[model samples]
Target: MSRIHKFVKDLAETRKTPKEIKTMVDTAFEVNSISQSQIYRISALVMAGRTLQTRRARTEKEGPYRRLY
Candidate 1:
């Protein structure tokens, strides 16, 4: 699982306000747990991967091991 996911789960489990959560997570992770820029980067990578898969789906629809399976 992602570090950010763990951070969020901790936040939820603790049931703290936003300011409290941020301070606690930052403290727990030494000020490097989660951030908006990092989340945005992950989202961008996921979207790009999906686009790449769609682009490749037309001519190469199955994996190389499909026939063996």
Candidate 2:
């Protein structure tokens, strides 16, 4: 995994808040070589508490069949 991924994983494992995670990710993108989109992606993954593969699998299982008028 990338350093950003590792950092986000560690933070999630410690139960970091979304605000804190956003601040850290923003700072990383501004002060480091990482891109903002990359940071956003990592933050989202951490918040979701699962790997991208797992998330995609779950979403596919759930489908997009919503009930509405």
Candidate 3:
């Protein structure tokens, strides 16, 4: 993983606040600043132990079709 992603994951694992994480990430990656809102989004994904696109698919059956997880 990229250093920024690793750093953010570490901080999220420690239960750091979004503000704190944003500050640390910004300081660590001065050339590529990230917004606090983005930090919140990343931290939430990290804490959830999954990525945004990794959700289970809908399992409902439709007449002749069904969704798989």
Each prediction's RMSD to truth: 11.0, 6.0, 6.6
Write candidate 1's Cα lDDT for 4-54 as tens digits.
554654454445455665666677678676775544433443444433244
What's the TM-score of each model vs. the native?
Answer: 0.38, 0.45, 0.58
Error of 3 at 27 (Å): 1.9
> If the candidates were sorted by their TM-score against the true structure, best first, what order would they fall in?
3, 2, 1
Best by TM-score: 3
lDDT of all predictions, in order shown?
0.51, 0.63, 0.69
| Highest lDDT against the true fold, candidate | 3
* Candidate 3 weakest ten by summed lDDT: 55-64
Task: Give candidate 2 regions above 4 Å deviation.
Answer: 1-7, 31-49, 62-69
Arranged by lDDT with the best first, the candidates are 3, 2, 1
Per-residue accuracy of model 3 over 1-69 as CA lDDT, tens digit each: 567766887888889998888878877788556666667877877787875344323222243365432
lDDT for position 17 in model 2: 63
Count of clashes, each model: 0, 0, 0
Candidate 3: stretches off by over 4 Å: 51-69
Instruction: State the local distance difference test value for candidate 1.
Output: 0.51
